[model samples]
Target: MDVLTAIRGRRSIRSFKGDEIEPEKIEVLKDALVWAPSAGNLQSRFFYFVYNDDVKRRLVGAALGQGFILEAPLVVVGCADIRRIAVRYRERGVYLYCIEDLACSIQNMMLAAYSEGLGSVWVGAFHENEVAGILEMPENHRPLAIVPVGYPDEDPVPPERVAHKDTVKEVF
Candidate 1:
């Protein structure tokens, strides 16, 4: 699917078919992350793919028992290399830029997954320290999101959105 079409079609897939994602498609999702525009081109964001069922169960536990996480075939974790950010761009990099960089890259990967006929959900409600430990993450690398990806079994309708009038204000 095209970019705009993917953007409009993308939904938080809470139910998955548990089908294996093609290795080539997984590569595409990884590429999308590396190519995401990073603040100051620092590119401190990183990802870890979890395919093991046991690990997925641990992740589900860390994510407040979001059982659906264990049902997806793959989980892509967005993490930040804070040490790299600190050295490259200092305090602002540590506190702000790295977080934004992670979000951008994760969004890119999500869009890439959708384009490749895969489903994914961005999971932020997680126990960061627990996930970091479970993933064997470095002390400076913080887990930002846990995105479960797979073939969707359920078609979830888009949730309500705030109307433009209330959400957007035009000064121009």
Candidate 2:
């Protein structure tokens, strides 16, 4: 699917089919992240693919029983390696800017998934520290978001958006 079509088709799928998502497709989704524009080309984002059932359950627990996480066959975690940023800006460390970079990359991956006829949901309501520890990430790497991917079993309509007149701002 084209960019605009994917953008309009992508939805926060809460129900997934029992079929398994192929690793090749998962790689395709991840490759989008590698090409995502990063801040100063730091390339500090790290992705973790969680396919194990037990681990998925742990993640759901960390997410306070958001069962859909465990239901999906694959979970992609978007993380930012803060230590890399700290190398150049020592005092500043990873900072919020790095988080934004990772988050944007995750969104790119989500869009890629949609183009491939897959469904994904961006999960931000979760325990970050617990996820970092579960993923065996270093102290400087922070978990930004979790995206569950698969063939959606249910089709829920996207909610209507506010008119552009109310949302767009002009600062002249």
Clashes of 1: 0
lDDT of each: 0.92, 0.85
Question: Against the true structure, whose TM-score is highest?
Answer: 1
lDDT of 2 by residue, 1-172 (tens): 7888888888899889888988799889878988887777888788899999989988998888899998898998888888877677554547765776787788888899888878899999999999998888888778988888998888889979899889999889
Predicted candidate 1, C-alpha RMSD: 1.0
**Top-scoring candidate (lDDT):** 1
Q: Candidate 1 regions off by >4 Å? A: none
Q: Candidate 2, which segments miss by more than 4 Å at Cα?
A: 89-93
lDDT, model 1: 0.92
Q: Determine which window of 10 residues in candidate 2 has minimal summed lDDT.
A: 88-97
> 1-172, model 1: which lDDT tens digit per residue?
7889988889999899957999999999999989998988989888899999999999999999999999999999899889889987899999999999999999999999988888899999999999999999989899999999999898898888888999989998
lDDT (Cα, 0-100) at 55 in candidate 2? 91
Clashing pairs in 2: none
